[model samples]
Target: MAPPVVPEAIARDYNEGAFVLDRSPRASAALARRCLEQVLEGYLSATGSDLKKQIDSVKEKVPENVYRGLHGLRTIGNFSVHLNKDTNTGQIVDVEPEEAEWTLEVLDLLFDFLFVAPARAQERIDGVNSKLKASGKPLIE
Candidate 1:
């Protein structure tokens, strides 16, 4: 089945980035970074400020695995961002395709963990609760 559309914008960015990975790794990395930022923003419920600060502030709140994934994405994407910066000579260095590919792979895992799995679990819980209510039975723990 297709994934639920919880965060549409982030999904769009991720899909577009994956689509263009081969032709433009730099672009792909940028989009993946934006996807990561959006996920962090929504997860932390803190925004409109420095992303690193927001992430740091939520260090204790986020699950260890999610935090690790976020840090990995940031580290890989930082190379893309730094290389994209214009030199004093007005030249931009592009990221290697491998870096962009890795970012996408991380995103795939994050999408399932951060969005899809929780949603599916909630759906299942709700379904069970609904059935219990209809049957005049206690809900499952």
Candidate 2:
């Protein structure tokens, strides 16, 4: 049997974002935004909802702090996208490296909260239930 897998879309975007971080912060930020979007979409879908097509959906789906973090990620990415475009028109608005980097940091926290911690908790629950069944104890509800 195949091992269980966490979704890879966010991870892929994070990798690409990190890869471009030094050279083009704007591109990196864009990928970070993609990661955040995919994570939110996954959360919404897990709750039997369809994909969250708008940025505001994060606010609706998550707690305030998580929503804020996601919003921050989006804001940085938006700045990068808009500023880069402005550069083409002789308007140079810059996205610092730190701004792009912060998105990845926030993503790490979200991944743990949204994916890793839950998976671990579920595994622990399954193990406890298995032991209870083997011992003739009533399983947890």
Candidate 3:
């Protein structure tokens, strides 16, 4: 199974974002933002009524870089939601060059920090403990 942090539904959202990135960067960015919020809400139990507040709630718990990335994704996603069109001209305004792509990159980093690293560390510990059990030695606590 995939990592528990990103359930299948969330992954699907992220993939859908990637699939439509070229045609509609704003849409892609919106999806990325949704996925990030889901991860924060579902896994971290991030508390707050809105994305910005939720991110602020978790700020002290995560490293500076991770916190910055979360805010970055939030900012970019806000652009997708709030700034996608010209209010006066009624014309679509595309995301800044590579801005949509950067959201995806930030998600990858968040996933690595919150999920993959912990799971891999547990796997290594289990492997070593199994050997210790076989040899009648105490397991690593």
Provide TM-scores for the models: 0.75, 0.75, 0.85
Q: Between 2 and 3, whose lDDT is larger?
A: 3
Global lDDT of each candidate: 0.76, 0.72, 0.84
Report, for all candidates in order, the number of backbone clashes: 0, 0, 0
The alpha-carbon lDDT assigned to residue 67 of candidate 2 equals 64
Residues 59-107 of candidate 1 have per-residue lDDT tens digits of 6766677667667677667767775555676676567899888888877
Candidate 2 stretches with Cα past 4 Å from truth are: 1-5, 45-53, 84-91
Off by over 4 Å in 3: 1-5, 84-93
- The predictions' CA RMSDs to the true structure, in order, are 3.9, 5.1, 2.9
Among these predictions, the greatest TM-score belongs to 3
